[model samples]
Target: MLWKYLLGFYMLLVTAAAFLYAPPALGLGELSRIIFFHVPVAWVGCLAYLVSMLNSIAFLRKQKLEYDRRAAFNAEIGLVFTILATVTGAIFSRYTWGEYWSWEPRQTSIFVLLLIYGAYFVLRSAIEDEEKRARLASVYSILAFISVPFLVFIIPRIYSHLHPNPIINPGKQMEMDARMFRVFLASLAGFTGIYAWFHNLHSRYLKLKAKFEEAEKHA
Candidate 1:
């Protein structure tokens, strides 16, 4: 309960900090405020996919349905966040670049990435047998995740981006203002907590569904 309160408080703090304390960057003006929300969700989405991949690996090795549920649910979460990230990034683009979207490397790669996971859901729905579905979905999640690092990290570098510079850059040793950075870090923590909460609930729900189906079959 305290953790829930902390999560809500964290979000409120980030919203306030995004609007009030995180001053507009030199070039982008107030539109840069979207960073507090957009980046965190996108980061969480990417993280979820990575977890899905690991779960898939476990499922394949152990043939356990629980791992499949994990992989499936996290992929669903990842897709939702990816959609949010795309929409928010589009809004940020419209304000800064005068277009909703373009063939910019970052946007292109992300769009392609979305398609890859979009196919995952479609694939899951198309399959009928529960155990079979889990196996194939696990395979798909693994392959999809293998491509993710390239989509998120490498493609942006290969093609030039209309996206703005990152708040912190390791190679360039760059960073955002101290105040802005602190709020950004808080936003990340809050969203990560939100992800954990949803993940647990979703996983439990799936397990319950399986149990109910088993009871019904016996009856």
Candidate 2:
């Protein structure tokens, strides 16, 4: 309970920092403020997908429904974050590139990633048997994650686009303003805490739901 309030307050501070504390970039001006939210959400989205894949692997090894449930919940959260990242990126692009979306490499790659995860849910729904669904979904999720690095890290860099240089430039050095970097790190920590909280809440809810369903079956 106390942690929840702390996280809320911390995120509020991060939001205030994005707009009020961080200075505008030379090229992007006020629009650059979006980075605090955009980059962290994107990072969280990737982290969620990675967690989903790891849980999927665990389920494959142990054949436990618990792991499957965790995998599914993480994938769902990842999908939501991915959508948020895409929308934010589109808004940024609309202002900076004069279009909401031009099918550039960055946009195109994320779109493809969205489709890949979107299919995971569809596959789960189409299967009737719980064990079969979990097994197949686990396999599919593992395969889908294989594309994440290529789509997010490689493709964006391989092609020329209007996207600005990341905080870590090609030389792999931090080129961000000191103040901006501090807020950026704070934002990342805040977002990651939010993800951990969400994952815990979701996992608990699923456990309760499963118990309720079992009781109903027994009754």
Candidate 3:
């Protein structure tokens, strides 16, 4: 219930900020303004996947059904954010790179990640045994998680492309001004808060679902 309230508040704040603060931060002239939403979504997507991977590991170690549910919920949320990130990134590319998409390594890796996790859900659906399903899903999640770093960092470094280099990298020129930074940070914080709220909701839903299934079997 607290999470629900927090989510509602965060969403309202984000919507207000998007209208009131975001435009000025985009230089009000550059299309790079999309980064306000794009960067935050991408960051949250990666963060969600990391949490999913960690939960997968925990499930494997503890054999707890709750961990499995957390992993699944995180992965689902991660997928949604990733899709938003990809689409927003494409829009940015069309404006900046003069194309809708390039065969950039980072982009390719993101696509692969999306496909892998999509397959994970398929695998879960095909399995009939609950224990077996959890075990297999956990394994696949770990493997996918291992690949994320390579996709996000390693592969992107090996090639030259129009995609911006990592912001935290030293010696990389930052194109953003101070005002843009403020709005960007705000968007990120707001989105992250929303993600946390959703994660709690999804985990609770999973727990309740498990309980319902258990009770049904007994009845």
Candidate 4:
């Protein structure tokens, strides 16, 4: 019940912030409104992957099914957010870059991430042995997380074409407008909260399903 109220509150806050704060942050009057969804989606994608990596490490160390379940849930959620990010990015590109489907380095990296995780799920389903499935999935999760930084950041920097460089370079003083930073932070927090709530719900459901299956087997 408390979780429900918290979820509702977070949803309301996010919706309100999206409407009231997003416009001025993007600085395009009305057309820049999509930042409300775009930024949050991208932020959540990274958050999800971080969670997956942590859970993967836990699973590898403890060899617990619960950790495996959590890792799988995090990966699934990450994939969803990644897809959202890709779609929103394409929309932004169409508006700003005048092309919806460019072979830009960043875009290609994101597409590769989508494919990698898509195969991750496929690999999980192809395995029937519970322990083997967990082991394989954990290995994949760690490998994928290890590759994410290179795919998303290092590659883009080493061979940049049209992607924008990071604002704060090494030892470079940087400043963001107060309003824009506030909006960006709020979007990040809201999206993270949503991911937490969803992850909790997913974990609970998986436990309950497992309990039910175990009871049936004994009966």
Q: What are the C-alpha RMSDs, in order, of all predicted structures?
A: 2.1, 2.0, 2.8, 2.8
TM-score of each: 0.90, 0.92, 0.84, 0.83
lDDT digits (tens) for residues 122-179 of candidate 1: 9999999989999998888777767766667777767777777677787886557777
Model 2 poorest 10 in a row by lDDT: 150-159
Write model 2 residue lDDT over 11-88, tens digit each, in one string: 999999989999998888999899899988888888998899999999999999999989989989989999999999
Whichever of 1 and 3 has more TM-score, that candidate is: 1
lDDT of 4 by residue, 1-219 (tens): 597787678768776766775545333445455666776887787778778778888988999888888888888999999999899889877877789878688778778778877888998999999888999988987887788777767665665476443433688754444655566677777788788888888988998999999999999
Give the TM-score ranking, best first.
2, 1, 3, 4
The lDDT of model 4 is 0.77
Which candidate leads in TM-score? 2
In order, candidate lDDTs are 0.84, 0.89, 0.79, 0.77
Q: Which consecutive 10 residues in model 1 have the weakest lDDT in total?
A: 148-157
- Which model, 1 or 4, shows the larger lDDT? 1
Clashing pairs in 1: none
